[model samples]
Target: MKRENLLVLLAGICTGLAALALTMLGNPANMGFCIACFERDIAGAVGLHSAAKVQYVRPEIIGLVLGSAVTALIAGEWKARSGSSPALRFVLGAFAMIGALAFLGCPLRMVIRLGGGDLNAVVGLIGFALGIFIGTRFVRRGFTLQRSYPARRTDGAVLPIIMLGLLVLFVAAPAIFRLSTEGPGSKHAPFFLALAIALVIGALAQRSRLCMVGGLRDTMMFGDAHLLWGFAAIFVTVLVGNLILHKFSLGFGAQPVAHSSHLWNLLGMTLCGWACVLLGGCPLRQLILAGEGNGDCAVTVLGMIVGAALAHNFALAGNPDSVNEAGELVVGGISMAGKIAVLLGLAVVLAVSVFNSRLGAKKNG
Candidate 1:
């Protein structure tokens, strides 16, 4: 294998292994490392949202930001930058999380879910690809977010430092810090072990710039499957690891913490996929970029946290038995989460059309 390919493969393996370790250590089923879910949990932990069921300080997420920061700084890639449609990126980030919660996973978790034999993730992946395909159409039509310029040093350091503070909180395990007594937030691996695994994965992801969105987008826009291969490795590694650990359960129904609503899964991930493409990376990529001093991505990350909070507060987030009960508004046996995805997808596409018109008017003027 080529050296670069080897690096990417190693990164994927690292992530897959970390996910397995987390699951074995007591993280929720098929939820070893989910950007959207973890952020929602963090939102709950910080009292941003009052969903008592999913509140915890996810150390892996904090580790991801800090590890990326450490790697970026060591590699001298930590130049602070911002101002590339920050507002729009923030909105897209929010929408991305909205859809992800509806589907109950991000792209990475989607892959891991598939590896664990959740056929529901298959539909989600299809929706993800469809969304990416549509977004690529916008790209072909000259959709642009302009450019990011240099910014202050503090702009880049803020999130990393905040993450470090979170790490301290995790260690302190203070009673006043609002942690989940039950649900996914309560399920976690050994604190230090999970943190160490997360740090390794985050460092590797930062170094390799691992992103499932970019991989799929590149494969679609070009014939390059190079990036896609790394993700494929992740899927296979996770699958094999799950099998060896007796964690692999094959079926569409009876999946842990998942709904059987296929259409909604497709729709939710569609929103996430389109927003990811528009923002130029997945949520994981945004975290890595934020770690590397991208203030715009940091703002985007902030948007995701807010989005998670809103999802929980509004009951927009889905769970295993919530398809017909207790989440968002259920209409005639259907949850409003799917409707939200459709509306969000439409709204974002409409925004793109408006941008296109403005650009055209400028050209004519």
Candidate 2:
């Protein structure tokens, strides 16, 4: 097998193992390594949310950055660079996290949720695909971020070291950042187990360049199938694992930290989907790409942090019982605003794509 193919295979396996560990450790089945949810929980740990039950610094996230950094360094893949519409990317990142939180998970989680038999994930998945399609249209136009410039080596290393620092903090202040007393944080696999799984996944993912955005982008842009194959592999692995563990459950009421509002599910993931497209990668892809020295990805990571902070501060996030003021859990589903935002966002993305494409055509002509 070619080296790239081997790496992709390893990536699929690692992702599967991570998902399985998440289920075994007591997260919702097939919910292992949800980039969005885990990050939101981390946001809560630093007091981003008043939701006490959800607060805790997840080791997997910290491990992902450091692990990817380690792999990139060993493989000579690290490169420090910047200047890809930094401000726009940052906004996209922030909104992406918001959308993901709204939906209760990222693209990775959407797929994994389906693996666990949550039909709600199907809505989210469709929304995500639609958003990516819209973003792809933008790409077909001349909508392009400016090229990045090389940065100082230390600048490249700084973010990864900070991630390492977080790992140490997890060790020194385990009690302070103690796994949640209840809720998702409360139900984690052992620290070392989580760390090991995260490290392996991070490394493999870095090598494979696995990304949810890329999955759709490739299919639309070039009719490529390799990245899609990796996604399929992960879905298959998680599905089988859920079956084997008997953790698969059908139906949607009273699931942990998930709401029944189908509109919000679609809207939330749509936000995440659009933002991921604009920023050029999903949250996990952002993390791995950042480790490989893509400063734009790092900016998106910062956007996620800020977005988390804002969500908690503004009461945008939903608890297990209910949503915020503007976010009502109506009888049929989520409120009208939720549905409108998805439409509006898509409209804006489409307009941008059309405008940019016309400009590009003129320039070429």
Candidate 3:
């Protein structure tokens, strides 16, 4: 195997193991790492919303950014760049978050849920692939967000510095942050331990350029499975680990942090997949890129944070399935507001894709 492919596979293995270990240590089931969920928690912690149950700054996020920054610097890969449709990217980022929250997990978490045998995630995967397929059509028609330019090092450093400050706030002044007394926010592995594991994974991801969206995107657009290998490795590793640990349960209902609304699961991830394609990366990729001094990605990350705040404030996030008073399953799903948001997001993304395409440009010209 090529060295780069091998590195990505290794990164996948490490990520799988890290997720399992974090769950065993204290993180939520099948939620050892979720960029969207963690960011939502961070937003709540910072008082961006009034979600009392999901408020707390996650250390994994802090570690992921810092780890990528340090790794990029060491590898001489860090460079400050920005200016490719910043405003549009921000809107894309927001919609992307909304979709992920509507589905209740990012692509990475979707894979993790699959590993844990959640049939609901299978529906999500189908939706995500369909979205990617749609996005690829736009790409084939010459969709372009235009070019970015180099900037001062300080511009790139801003995100890393902010991540550092968040770390400080998490560690030095925990009292000031609105920590969750219950729910996903309250569940976590040890702070330093989660940070340390995430740092290692971040370094590996940075070196390997691992991304879930890139995996499928490359396969459809270029017929390359190079990036997909990493996710494959992650799935195999997690599947094996879950089985051995007896954490694997195959079913459509009663999964942790997930709802059984198949239609929304499909549509929500479709929105996420399409938005990430236009943004040129997934949420995880955005964070890694931000760490590598991409100012545009940093803005996208901030937009995601804000989107998380909006999700809870507007009651647009999905709810997990629950057992009701009669001891029967109550299928949880997003509200009508969430449904409208996803549809609107799809319309907006479609518009962006069309206007940014060569065909659209020719018509305008």
Candidate 4:
């Protein structure tokens, strides 16, 4: 393999190891790092969710954005710009988190879930791929965001600094933030250890542009599995790590903070998959891209924070025991309504994009 490919492979291994170690240390199984879940916890810390059992200011997320920023600054990759369909990207981010929560994990969690023997993750992965395929179709049809212009350095760096501030606060005031009483937040690696792992993963992910959603999308659309190779490495490494840590629990009868509803696992990830496609990357990808001064992604991250708070305030978030009042099993409930809303919203946005693109083409002609 080429040197660049080799770097990506190593990076993927580190990603898996970091996640596995987090789980082995006490995080929910296969849930070492979930973008949506962590954001939800953060939301609760700031009073977004009153769910006392699931509240904490997560430092990993803060490290992700700030770590990427540091990489970009050192590499001279930071460039502030916006106007890439900002509102649309925001909507996509919100929906992506919603979908991820429904499945109880992000793409990273999906693979880790698989490693830990959660068969439902297989369905979620498939659904995620299908969602990406749908988004790819739109891309083929000329789906594109608007161009972005350069902005001030502060405009780009502000969010990262803010994230860093949050991290400092977390380290100083874990009690005020409200660590989980009985959930994933309660079970954690030591503060410095978790921070170190997150920092390493964040730096590597920043360099590799490794996104779980983007990996499969690249393969299906461009016939390039370079990104997928990273994931493959992650899977193998994490599986081995799980074995060594005795975290390998075969057959998922009742996994921690996970549900057994296969259909929801599939559908939720489908929505998340599609949203990631539309937004141009997954949650992790958005953070990395934002660090590189992609203002559009920055806006999307803001949308996710907002959406997470909304999810909990509105009783949309699930508990650590995998019990969501709005789960797929709840017919004629809020979850169903949320699903319908997401589908219709996406359809409307897509139709508008198509119509606007055609009109612009005609005018130019």
Per-candidate TM vs. native? 0.93, 0.88, 0.98, 0.90
Candidate 2 per-residue lDDT, tens place, 91-126, comes to: 677778777767777898877877777777888888
For each candidate, the alpha-carbon lDDT, in order, equals 0.83, 0.74, 0.93, 0.75
Q: Estimate the overall C-alpha local distance difference test score of candidate 1.
A: 0.83
After superposition, the stretches of candidate 4 with alpha carbons farther than 4 Å from their true spots are: 172-176, 318-365
Q: Indicate whether candidate 1 or candidate 4 has the larger TM-score.
A: 1
Query: lDDT per residue, candidate 3, 1-365, as tens digits?
Result: 99989999999999999999999989999999899999999999999998998998898888889999999999999999998889999999999999999999999999899999999999999999999999989987878777789999998888899999999877888999999999999999999999999999889999999999999999999999899998898888889999999999999998999999999999999999999998898898999999999999999999999989999999999999999999899999999999999999999999999889965467546
**Model 2 lDDT, full chain set:** 0.74
For 12-120, candidate 4 gives per-residue lDDT tens digits of: 8988888887876766667788878887778778776677766777767876887788887788877887777888778777777777777777888888888777777
Worst 10 residues of 4 by lDDT: 328-337
| Per-model tally of clashing residue pairs | 1, 0, 0, 0
Each prediction's Cα RMSD? 3.5, 4.0, 1.4, 3.6
Clashing pairs in 4: none
lDDT of candidate 3?
A: 0.93
Best by TM-score: 3
Q: Is candidate 2 or candidate 3 better by lDDT?
A: 3
lDDT of 1 by residue, 210-250 (tens): 99898999989997777786789889999999899898988
